[model samples]
Target: MLDQAQMRYFEGNYQACFELCLKGLEVVDENLKEKFVELAALSALKLEIPQALEFCAQSYHWHKNSYFWTLNLAKALIIQQNYAEAIKLLNAFMGVENPLKLEYLHALLRAYKGQNTYNEVENIYAILLKNNPNDLQLWLEFGEYFEFIPKKALGIYQDCYFFINQKLQALEKNTPKIEVLQTFAQDSLTARFNMQKTQKTLIENPEILNLKNFVNTILTQRIAESYLRIFESPLQEAQKAAQILYSVQDKNLQNAEFWFIFAHALEYIKDYAQAEQAYRYIFAIPNAPKNIANTAAFHLAYLLMRQERFKEGLEFYENRLAFAKNTTFSQEYYQIAKNAFLQDSKVFTNKEIFVYCEQGFGDTLMFSRVFEVLCKIAKKVLFAPQSALYPLFSAKLSKENCFANLEILDRIPQDFDFALPLTSLPLFLGLDTLEKIVTLKTPIISPTNKRKSRKIKRIGFFWHTDFALKENNTRNFSLEFFLNFLLELENVKLVSLQVGDFVLPECVENAGVGFKDWLDTYKVMENLDGVVGIDSSPAHLALICGIPTLVILQPRFDWRFGLYEAPKAKFYGENAHLFVSNPNDFSTKNTIIEKLKSIF
Candidate 1:
């Protein structure tokens, strides 16, 4: 039964595995209890919380003193959002003298940290340090825990600094690989310690030149490892580094590496104009590698696009494609060029449309608005990824179009007038402004009813779950945050207009009118008084539907949303509002709340 449950879990039958674990827990022998614990842990990981919790309770009852069972119970409780109980169980497990006690303690500390129980977390660290006095990493971890707490950080910093310094001093003159690994571990801890300390200090004193120099030295010494650390640290450090580098008299200091760092710093500071100039400088280097040049051009083009200088951006993208080393980058450049052309009227006419699929199905769906315009203007439209999307497009667009793979393009039709990429339809259609092209006519809500809601303002909300390529997991705001925002609003009915396999919040799901299809979402959106979301298909759909839409954008967002030039995007013209958080400071939760309030 246990083997079958494990196999079912591996096969993605989470519901079946969860049920099996519950059935196994009924016969509570030692082996069955162990199996129940393992299956419960697996079920918790699979997000089947009810069954996980049930099995976990049975496991704890069978072996109350077992740390593994208690840990699994804690994990299941955490999954069920019973953090208080989870923390209690974790604390019980932490009292054990086993090797895994430290790991359990760490998990408890993390749980307490997530709940903002800073004192509890500090207590755990202090206890851990007393138990393992020789563990340098523990000292560093404690420092990291206090890094954001201004009042408590000083003591933590001093402890980590001393521990790491002592380890560094003890390093032998001739060390083996094992010793080197130990040294590296200490160095990493030290790096993190300095980074956090310097960040806190920089926040308080932005013009600390000496501290800036110290950070720069560390960054230069550990270039690769320090990149992410420096990049994510306080913006003031990068600004100070850029200022120090800019003030240097030596011409040799203006190398690709220096300029790239400077550009990154400027970008972090939201000085897009200066970042643009820095990228241009990199592009002008006499013997710059193709990859570097291509990158510079891409950034330059992206900045230009953000500034709404579509003509210049299109030119730069063309240059990028001409010299691009990687096929993927070249393809991306081509797609950008095509999209830029769709927005600019100057280059829309007499162009042959070449449609190549890029990114994901959702992106392709969002950009498919260009296809209708292309069919009307282009002499011939050639679509790639012919086998997959051809039938779909054919059903949507009942026109004579050529669909072929890249390899079969040798036999060009002689009478073709002009060729343009599919994404270039906006530029080709001469729709420079969103107001100029986007029709305000809302989609008909029902078969015989075209009336708007009279009592309440219909607000459409879309939360995206398709950011697979995004690095930061926090980019996807919790459903709790959205629910909090919705609960505070007045005279508004919040409708979930999201698509794909998004896990809707309990608040949203329990609101009674849950949708199961895109058609239903679209129909609801068509009658909305206003719409708001991140950069997703529904946001685009609301824009196309001519509803007033607000896009809550990330600070350093994708170039497609025009990140560099227009801080407030003009994507959907005056009807569309873009609200961006401060990149330097991540404490904009209140700012977002206030913005939503103002809108309401």
Candidate 2:
């Protein structure tokens, strides 16, 4: 009965085998109790039965000396997330040289990882590699441990590919022996029989096929992802990733993950057309991973928007809501949830809406106009503005008296029908056309005081602005370079718009001292002739207030800026002077310098 049950399991009929094993365990002889229990436990695990862990525990309890059952019990504990017990059990077997040493190390790895002791996980990985240096699977496991920290993982994945390829080459070299037998088949019947048998044997060897799959599918994914992460060499690394991904069999056509990465690589390499096609392919797959598909949609939309295809881009942008969370913009950075946010095209007539602030101070200020638009549609609008700008928003919204339904809150409210990030308002309103979307105009914040007539012109200037983003450093130029250029101008008094512990020269008037809020900055900005700064909130404020604004944008500016060389952004319409700083083109900064001279 045990042999029959084992045969059923081997034949892939786990349900039948599970039933047989469960029935056999009740009537099995004591002399054969371990075999029946072990078989039942293995079958239960395959079928994912609740009793799998119980059976394993029972087997191990009966025969504590059995290494096989001990390993099984440890595995059960790990699966149930009882990491301490699993770690204790695995740790006991570590010193001895046993047949299941690798399995034991991996169990320890899982337990350590569950406990978040990454140092212990790394130690286990080091030991695994030291003992099994030539194993590609071990290298793959090591690479996955540093998934977010790609810089550390890239080398490990590359090494895995090297070893996997070597194994593949060895397999290819041995193939000629079978061919030799086939070549001499006409000379003898025995040669023909030998050739046929050898072919059958080779076909049955799943190890070689599995090794090739490691190179083609999983390894390709790891290596390409790592290549895409290298920021310094975006174009170069993206090209390499595209090359490696392209080399995969079947062109990775049916694989959503493959197509997603391929699309990103195409975008990086500036092949917009193929990138668009690759992104579209993932959307066609009905069963594609929700996160991967949504990400593909985002990249596709961004790619189109970069090329001035606004309506098409906006359509794709809406697809991202399928995976968006019902949370704050700041929480959206770290939180991932399924399509819980509003995406079903539900109308909000007579419904209370919860609008949360997203991104940064500049982004919040930029998107705050949407609240007024939202107020008209929803019966009651509960707006949670950024904490820093809460006082100013409360004050300003009160003065406008635009909507009796709108209420600004310093913190997130408990009751709301639906929620959205302020930036996502355009998509919710079905404003697919760029013309319908709101732009920064003086209406949002009219000048508090008209510009005073003076012999000397006052211009707001800032050389440093930090958003805590990865690409923020590239947006900043040398302060000395800015100071030298500014001090050279005649009849121009520079007012430092610098905030947060910035030291300014005596020649430049300090304007950001003891600032209560953005309203204080707005009061000072309203009196200035013009404002010039790197991509920052003050620049947004200046544009919205109808002040002449000169913004020095880095080459990798925000998506809102549109084309690289455009004189003005479509959204920052009022008094916008945007110049992209391209290091390759020396004239980029020189042009800004010329604009500064004229503005000052």
Candidate 3:
């Protein structure tokens, strides 16, 4: 029996070995106490916890002062996650009267803290403080622990800092007067107390000076680490910072650095009025860097554009062109000149409209609509980057529409009539009323197989190209959203009348009806039931085609969506239906779906 028990124990068969040992103890009691203790420890190690605990109890009963058996029981309780019971057993083993009892007490306190028993932790801390009243580190730790616990421990941190300061003051060889020390401590305490109170009040009303100072200190000290992070803060927080900086009395703080932040903050809030004012402040500053001034001028023009003051905005661009040196505003100046021409009734008597390619192939293609209009007034010459657009334009436009156009070259035309950039069509044509322009009556194409079988509704689809803009940041909707809507609708044979390289959605693609050029796209648009897309060239093309178009506008976009009033008459003309959503509205998907349903 002994041999079997030994074998089982060696093989780590704890239950079997424990059972055999118990049976052996029942049969014979010679030298059994030591054997029981060893078996209990082994069983506990094997995690046969209940049996091990019972054995420990028996061993402790036989030898009342056996600390080893008591410790084994405590360890078993700890392994079972009964920390409180384990602490009690450890305390009993340490015998409260022992000199090393404090060590075990500290361990119990740590165990309570590890379990997040804050009250127990505080009680133990209180005991330790009572025992060692002069330990400064302990006092500081206690103060730190109490920092977040409301009014109950409000003075602890002050007291800790005061005591530490006093100790340092005492160590000085030139001892200050008792009155000075007392005054300093009192002042320190008052300052700390007032800081907490002011912080609360500032959070409640951020415009206050004390709160502003606190925020400025944090922002300025951490600016190198947190400049971008500060820009990314909530618009309200950034606005508060901007306001504080605006009100600063320091001349150095009122420079472009401060105004740039202020401008961005106002921009984020869509406070274009205030943002324009801030940008102007930066522009007015003497000796401002060329890039900064140019940016300010650009943004100011953008604001004016948003407000539909296109003439005034173009003037700002012209001013930048005149004054700002070595900047991109020169290109922008060309754009503004064209915009001014398009929007106003300013006659271009022999003026050369210089059409240089600005953004993309599709963009150049769309803006080429200006050539037809310009040909009526000015000696038109296109300075484009793409050779492909040249042939496309030649094929699409007639002899009268084509001016003495030269190839894309590095130098400007020495002898020309008044010049206007291509994208400035909106300005040159005075984009006011749809009824004024002559509409094309010719059918874009003959009936195809897809159009012959079904009663076609002439639905137009434009899944805007991802690469059409700098990033997807500019385009508003995804392919799936449009495709899903098209797939569910009936009685509508959708046509891809989209201009640009923007991929058509799967439904449009699978229908095998897509256009590759602006001519073909506009031709297809002329036959569509209606045009549907986020802000894109097709929307413009449809408007020009005199067809009904539904434009899904993003929040706070260009004034083309008609921010000033419903029917945004100044931008998209009266015929366009503008579908817009607010920033706070989370139901954009549902709104789009409903709008599509109504159109279908």
Q: Give Cα-based local distance difference scores for all models.
A: 0.56, 0.72, 0.54
Which candidate has the top score in lDDT? 2
Evaluate residue 11 in candidate 2 and report its C-alpha lDDT on the 0 to 100 scale: 95
Q: Any idea what lDDT model 3 has?
A: 0.54
Residues 59-159, model 2: lDDT tens digits: 89888977787888888887788889988987787778778888888888888999989789878988888888767767877998876567778987877
- Report the poorest 10 consecutive residues by lDDT, candidate 1: 173-182
Per-residue CA lDDT of model 3 for 361-396, tens digit only, reads 544544454455555566545464344344444443
Q: Could you tell me every candidate's TM-score relative to the true structure?
A: 0.48, 0.61, 0.47
Between candidates 1 and 2, the one scoring higher on lDDT is: 2
Which scores greater on lDDT, model 1 or model 3?
A: 1
| lDDT of model 3 at position 290 | 71
Model 2 CA deviation exceeding 4 Å by range: 1-130, 141-153, 175-201, 249-251, 307-312, 319-362, 371-382, 398-407, 411-421, 428-430, 438-443, 448-539, 547-556, 563-568, 579-592, 598-600
Instruction: Between candidates 2 and 3, name the one with more favorable lDDT.
Output: 2
What is the alpha-carbon lDDT of model 2 when measured against the actual structure?
0.72
